[model samples]
Target: MNSKKTSQTEHPPGRSSTPAAWGALAVMASLLAAWIFFESLACGALHAGLTCASWMRGDQLSVGKLTYEGNGIFRANDVEFVFGTTGHRSSWKSERMEIHPLHLVGMLIRGKYQSFRLIRELKVGKSKLLVDRRGAGDGDRGEASLPWSESFMNPANFFPSSIEGGPIDVVVIGDAYRLSLSGLKLLLPDRWAGKVAFDEAQLDMGTWHGTFSHGAAVAGWDGTSLRLENLNLGKETALHEVTLALRDGRADFGIRGTIGKALIRGDGAFGSPGDPNALELTLVGENLQLGPLAELLGQDRRASGTVGQARFTFRGEPDNPLEADSSLRLVANNFRWDGRGWDSLRLAATLTGRKLTVSELSLQQEENILTGKGLVNLTRDWHEALKSPFTAAFSATLDDAGALASLAGPQFATLSGGLAMEGEVRGAENKATGYANLQGVGMKIHGLPVDWMKGNLLFEGDHVVLSHLDAWCGQDNISMEGSVQNSQPHAYKASAQIDVHNLTKRLGQLGIKTATTIGAGAVKCSWQGEGTREAHSGSFQARVTEWISKWTATGMSGSFDGSYAPGQLRLTKAEFLQDELKLSLKLNASARTLEVTDINATRGEKEAPLVQGSIALPLDAMDVWESGDVLRTIDTSGPFAINLALRGIKAEEIEELLGQKVRLTGALEGTISANGSLENPEIHGGLKIGNFVSLAGEAPADLNLTIDAAHGEFKGSLSEAIGQTPLLQMELEAPLRVVKE
Candidate 1:
C-alpha cells in the first residue's frame, strides 16, 4: 500500500493509478469538503440566531436545519431564542427562516473585504416574545422590573416596514397583569447609522390602553433610556378614570398599585432635561378625599354643612424646590349652618405660595346676608408677612324683621332694624389685632326705634375697645366709651357712660308718658358689670337734673344709685313723687317690697299753714301702663288749654282731686291708692279730669268740704252733710259719691 501511494502521487500525465489508491484519495477529499460545508452552515445559523443553544433547555429552542443558497446566502428555519437580562426573562420564536447575507459573504470571502454590506431586511412569520419572572432568574415571585425599562431584543438590520405586513406583537406578564403590544415598530437612531422607524404602537394592560401613532422612539443599549413622542394613555379603574395625551413633552411614569389603578399619577416631563428648573405642568383627575385631606392638613370640616368641589394646581422648579398655586370654588344650597339655614351660598378661594386668599364669599338666609373678602398669609418670615398683616374686611347686613323672626324668642322677635359692620383683622405669629368702624347700628326694642349709630371698635389680645360711640333714639342722643376684658358672649367687665337729652321723650319711648317736655334733663351714669353665660351683675349710679315735668302735678330731681345682681335690683337714694309729697323709699326688687319712711306732704301754699301727711306706699299695688301715644296735643291758640288724661289712673280719683262729683266716660285714668299715698296706686277706671282745686289758708273746725261731681262717679269722700271733728288731726272720711249714671 505504501509503494502504490507513492507511485500514484508521483504519476504525471496519462498515468493510471491502482483502483485502491484512487478510491482512498477520492474518499479523503470528499470527507474534507463535507466537514468544511457543515461547519460553515453551523456558524452561519448560530450568528443569525444570536443565541447560544448550548446553555438552553432542549424544549426552549426549536431551531431547524440551516441551508446555504447562492451568492454566500445562509438561512435557518423554525428558530426560537430564549434569554434574560437583569430583571427580565423572555423567549422569542418564528415559524419562517432568516438569512444574513453579510455573514455568508464574509465567511465565503475568508475575511477579505472586512467592510461589506448585505441584505437590509429580514422577516419571520408569527413571531412571539414573552417576559416572565421564571425566565428572569429571580425565582418565580415578586415584581420583576418596570415594564417600560425591561430588556428586549430586535433584529440587527431589519427595518420595521420589512418585517411583514405590519409590526410584530409582544406579550409581557408582570406583577399586576398581562401586557400586550400591537403594531410595534423598531427604531434605530441616526447615530447608529441604521434606517428604521417605529411608526405606530399600542399597549393593552388590563383596563389601560396606550397607543402611539405617527411617532418614533429609539431604545438605547442596555435599554436604560427611551425617547418617544405622540403618546397617549387611557385608564379605567375603581377609583377614577383618566386619559392622558402627550406631545412635545417628556413622559415620566411613577405609578404604584395595580397597572391601571394607581393612587397617584406622576407622568410628564419637567420641561427639558437641561432646563428642568422651568418646568410647568397640570395634573387632572386626581381624586383627593375630603376626609383624608382634612386629617392630613389639620383642617376640619366640622361646620354644619358639606364641602362640595375642590381643585389644586402645582407649579415649580424640578431641580431646586417646588411650590403651587391652588384655587377652589364651592357651591351649596339650603345649607344649614350657624344655627340657621342658608340659601344661595357660594365660596371661592385660592392659595398662592403660603397665602390663602378668598376672592368672593357670600351667604344668604332669607333676608339676612353676609359677604366677606380677605386673605390669610401663612408665610414663615414674620417681618415680611406682618407687613401685609393677613388682613380681612367684611360687611354684614341683617334685615331686622327676618333676623328677629328667625331668633323668634321674646328678646329678638319683636326687634326690627338693620345692622352694618365693616372690619379689618390683622395678625402675625401668635398675636392678632383688629380694628373696625361701625355705622348704621340700630335697634328697635318693644316698638321703640333707634337710628343710625356711629362707633369704632377695636380688638387687641383678649380685650375689646368701644370708643367714640354716638347714638340717637327718638328725641334722645347717647354717647358711650368703654373697654371690656375677656370679652365673649357673656363673660366680660365693661365700664361705660351714658348721657341723655329730653329725658321725658326717652321715658315715653320706653312707654312712659307725662305732660311736659320740661321733664328733659341730662343724666350722667356709670355702670360696671360682669356676667356669666346666663346672667349679668352690675351696679349703676345716675344723676338727673329733673325727675318730673314742672307743668305736670309734680316736679322733682335727685341722684340715685342702683345695683343689679342677677335677679335682684335695689335702689338707694332720695326720691320724691309729687311737689307736695316727700319720702325716702327703699325698693327691694327680689322681695318685691317697698318701704316708705318720713313721708310728709303739704296741700296749701307756702305762705299759709300747710296740710302735711305721713303715709306708707305698697309698690305691688301700683299699676303701670305703657304709654301708647307720645304726641300730647295742646291748643295754644284756643281760650282754654286742654288737659290729657294720665295713662295709669282711675275716674273716681279725678272727681275727688278736683273736689267735684264727676263721672268720666273716657279711657284715660289716674292712679290712686286706698293707703292715701301716691307711691302705690291703681287706676280704678278711665277718666278725663279737667278742673281746678282751690286751697284755703287753714282747715275749718268742721272742715265742711263741699264738692260738685259730674261726668264720672266717685265714692269714699265727704258726703250728705257728714263730717269729722278735730279735722286738723282727723282722717277725712265720707261717702259723698258721683256715679256715671
Candidate 2:
C-alpha cells in the first residue's frame, strides 16, 4: 500500500483491492435490499390498516409476502386472517393471488362489496370448504388491493381512518361460516358498545353471504357472555334481548323474539357429553298467524288458526326420543288442519322412558267439545305414539250435533239436535275395543222429528253393534237393534218395533200431507243388508193390524213387505183390510215408474170383486197423492184390464167410502168391465139395489144405475121404483176428450 501511495497513479482507496471490490458490491446490494425491505413493509402495513379501517374495523391479518407487479398490481401468498369479532384464526394458502391495488381507491369510495370466486382450499374450523364457482355468480364481482407499498411512501395515507369502498372482492372470511360474500357491506361502530349493520352478502356455511337487510344490532361481550340488542334473523324474524354464554364446550343461551307477528321466548343449554336437547321453551301468543311460523319449522301448513301458547321441556338423547324425558303443554285457538277445524284446544302431556302420560286434553270443534286423559306406550321414535297400544277414556258433548253435517251426508242439513256421550277404548292399533252410550233430545232427520233418541254402541275393530236404540216422537215411538261387521264391504242386520198413535197428526208435525191414510198401528220391521262401501242392498218387512183411513170407517188393517236397493224397489206383499173389505197389491218400482204385478180387491164374506187387474204407472201419481191433490193430471204407460163386481154394498158403507156420514142400509149388485189406457178409458157397469132401508123404515123400491163410456162419450142413468111404481129417474151424459190433461 505504501508503494502504491508513492506511485501517484492513485485509483481511490481500496478500489483495486479484492476486499474493496467486495465492499463496493456490498453497498450496492445493501441499497437494493433496503428498497425491497421498504416495499414489503409498506405493502404489509397499508394492507392491515386499510382493511381495519374500511372492511372490518377489528380485522387483523398476516401475509407471507405481498409483492408489487407493476401497473398498481400486487400479489400475496399464504395469508392468515382474523376477521370481525371472532378471535379465531384462519389461513389461506395458495401459490399466488392477483390484485390491482389502485383499483381499491375508487372502490373504497363507492360503499359496496364484491363477490369473490373462490377456486382453492378454504379452511374453516376443521371443515374443508370449496365455494361453488357457478354459485358465485358473475354480477358485482371484482378484486382489488390496497397499494400498501405505495401508500407507505405517502404520509397522507396513514391519516385516513376510513374511506368508502365500492363493491370489491377481498379475501376475507366470515365470523361464523366460511362463505364467499357478494355485494358485501358492513357498517361497524366506532366504539366497542356501538351498533353494527350489514347485508346484501352471500352465505355458504358460517359465512356472511345473503341479501339486503336494514336490520341494526348492538352487540357487547362481557367476559363470558355475549348479548345482542335488536338483531334481525331473516326477512321475517327479529330477536331482542338475546344472550349467549359459551364456555368449556357448552353453550347457555336465552332469546326473546318475534316470528312475523308472533312473540316467542326461550332459554336452553346445549353441548357437552350428556344432553342432546336440554331446554325449556315457552311461547305465548294471542291470535298469532300460523303460516310463517310453520315455514320457520320447515313444514308446509296451509291452515288458518291462532296459536295461543305452547310450553315444551326436554332433556335426553335425540336418537331415542321415547327414552327421553319431556313435557309439553300446547294451547291453540281456532286451529285447523286436514280440512277440519277446531274452536280451541288445550293439551298437556309428559313422557318418561317408554310411556307417555296425558294429564289433560280438551278440544272444542264446531259445536262439539271433547275431553280425554290417557296413557300409552311408545317405541324408540316419537311417531309411533299415534298407532301404539293403549287405553283411553273420552267424553264428548255436542251443543248442536247437526253442525257436524259432513259426517252424515246431506241429511243433516234438515236435522238439528245435540248429543252427550262417553266412551272407553282399549287395545292395539289394528284391533281395538270400544264402548259408547249416546243420548240426544229434540232430534230431527230428513224431516222426521223425534223427541229423543238414545243408543249404546260396542265395537271391536271394524265390527260394530248397536245394542239398543230408542226414538220417541210424540205419538210415535220406535225401538231398534243392529250390528255391522267387517271392513269396507260390510254385512248388517237390524230390527225395529214401532208404535203409532194418530199417524196423521205426526205426519202433520213433519210438514207432510197425504191424500189418503190406509192405516195406523204397531209396525214390526227388520232387514238384512250387505254391500261394499259404495252400494248396498237390503230387504224389509212391515206388519200392522187395525188400520184406519180418512175416507173409511175406523176398523182397518194392513201388511207391507218390500225389498230395496239403490236403484230399485219392489213390494213383495201388501194386504189391506177394512171390516169385510180386503185388498192385496204387489208392485215393483224404479226411479221413474211403478209397475203393478198384481192387484185385487173384494168386499163381504162372499169376497165379491170390487176391483181386479193391475195398472202400469209411468211417472206415477204418488207425488199427487202425497200432496193431497187428487185432481192432478197423470199418465199411464199401457192399457189396463180391470173388473169390479159391485156386490153386497150397503148404503152406510157406500157413504163411508165416499167420505160421507149418510145413514142408510141396502145391498147393491153390479158387474163392471174396464179396458184401455188410463188416458182413454172405457167402462160399462150396471148396478141394482134392492131392500133399501132408510133411517125411518124400509123403502119399497129398487134402484138401478148404469154407466157406459164409448166413442169419446160417457153416459150414466139412475132409476128408482117402488115395486112396479116409478119413484125417480135420471140420465147424465158427458163428452170425453181423447187427450188427457
Highest lDDT: give the candidate number: 2
For candidate 2, the TM-score is: 0.55
| TM-score of candidate 1 on Cα atoms, chains taken together | 0.36
lDDT of 1: 0.47
How do the residues 314-355 of candidate 1 rate in per-residue lDDT, one tens digit apiece?
454332221345566666556552245666567888766667
TM-score of each: 0.36, 0.55
CA lDDT, candidate 2, residue 64: 74
Best candidate, TM-score: 2
Q: Give a tens-digit lDDT track for model 2, residues 1-741.
A: 889777776555643568988888999998888687866766777576656554332334556767766655556665554432222323333444444443545544543442221111111111112222221212212323255632343323222221222232323342233444333232222124634444433444322234434456776643345677888767577888788776454668888888788887877775432344433333344445777766654455745577778777766543344666888888888766534567987899998877788988887887688788888887644455545777788887876666445334555556667778899877655356889898888877766778899999987776788899999987678888888764546667676776766655566567776556443445555555555567777787776665555665566667888888877788899887777777788977764566675666677566556556565555444564475443343445355555656556567676776567877777778777777766677888898888776656656578899999976789999998888899889999999755546
